[model samples]
Target: MSASTAVEKVNLREALLTRRRARTPAERESAAEAIALHAAALPALARATRVAAYLSLPSEPGTGPLLAWLAGRDVPVLVPVGRADRSMDWVEHTAGAVESGPLGVPEPSGRPLGPGALATCGIALVPALAVDHAGNRLGRGAGYYDRALADFPGVVCALVHDDELLPHVPHEPHDRPVDLVLTPAGVFRPSRDRDV
Candidate 1:
């Protein structure tokens, strides 16, 4: 990472942390709506056969509507189940098949599916606190998604509200860049200028 990029990321991280602490319930609700609108507009979502999406936590990007749409279309939907090392495994889930897990996140009640299961998915909707124009994602500082997405060779998209798509995010070498950014406005192909 360049020195300027590093400084920019630090500022973004601080801003995001402050924003998360200050967000009201209404703001969160609006953010969820934004996510839904953007996700619904993405044509790649309709073409995906298998999709790996995150199970939303209270403050995270909401996936309920998107998951429901995918299930209605008979597309295979999977949610991540966090492992011991902050890595994750995808598991199939449907409208009535999810149950609250130990961590309070919704997960599939059936057997855990493997990472290889995402091999056929044309798109994967990843959750992020913030993302940059270059696609560097700022998660909650846990490297789970970063590690989990390491092998996904297909389109990896980050879901965030328009405001969350900030100018920069605190990123390290291990952090992965998303191929696309899905915001309430539309889908964007992040600039490749910052590629490592």
Candidate 2:
């Protein structure tokens, strides 16, 4: 990536993180509820027999509600456990199957299902700092999701706050794009020529 693009990503992540950290507990709870409701209504999520999702950090939009909602419906959920190679491994997110993962991120506490497990998921709820109008997603800079999703053909959704769904965000060629952006307000389906 160009130096300017890298710089832009770093600056954007910092700005977004600041905004997330400033949210009050009540706002977080409300956003979490909205996200869960709206996301659950998504056609992809609604139809998927199994979906891949991650636990949200305190600052990000919560995924616990969505996970529970999915599990309650008998829809299996796969949660990521970061790997040493910057790849992601999946595990069934059953009750009590979460523990403090790398960098304190909550992850599935079971044996990994390996990177190939993502293929079984029809949709994925990925965390993002922001998503651009063109469907480009700005992640937390480790490139873990990008690498893990390189060959994934499922519906990719990024869970972000309403304001974070911007018209533009700097991106590199290696960055993976999301097919949908699920915020509290609604879902943004970017124009992409793909059969999801």
Candidate 3:
């Protein structure tokens, strides 16, 4: 990473940590609003026939409004269910029909989807603790998303607060970068090249 990028990363990391420490219920609510507004700006999301999204946890970005909006649009939404080894399994969800899974993340009450089923999705909305300009994503330090997202063949975006958009994030060659970063402010292209 460039020196400037490294510095930015440090600053962003600090900002996120500070915010996380001081986060209030009202702040989370505000962040949720921002996420909805920014997600609405993505035309691909509306046009997508199938989408993958995560169930929100405390301190993570919220998906309630986004999921509700997508349901209103009659979009097929999928949420991740944790597996035995900390990997993810996707399941379809309909409005007012979600259930709590092992990790307390909301999931579809219907049958769970296998890994092969996720390959056909047109969009994947990932959850993240932080993301960088290069598309590098820092999740909750788990490899679930990194592994599950490998087969996704469409637009992959990470939902995060504006403060979570870091200038750089630690990554390995095996890590996957999201195509876009969706925040309340707007949708940002993490990298010009989509291949990353």
Question: Which candidate number maximizes TM-score?
Answer: 2
- Model 3 segments more than 4 A misplaced: 1-18
**For each candidate, what is the lDDT?**
0.76, 0.89, 0.78
lDDT of 3 at 109: 76
Better of 2 and 3 by lDDT: 2
Model 1 Cα lDDT, one tens digit per residue, 1-196: 6798667666776877677767777777776777677777677776678888877776666677778777778988887787776667777876777778766777777787776776767788888888898888887666778887788877889987777887767688889889888776777789975221
| Candidate 3 per-residue C-alpha lDDT over 14-36 given as tens digits, one digit per residue, 9 for 90 to 100 | 66767776888788878887888
Better of 1 and 2 by lDDT: 2
The alpha-carbon deviation from the true structure for residue 138 of candidate 3, after best TM-score superposition, in angstroms, is: 0.2
Superposed on all Cα atoms, model 2 deviates from the true structure by an RMSD in Å of: 1.0
All candidates in order of lDDT, best leading: 2, 3, 1
2 or 3, greater by TM-score: 2
Native-referenced Cα lDDT, model 3: 0.78
Structural similarity to truth (TM-score) of each candidate: 0.83, 0.97, 0.85
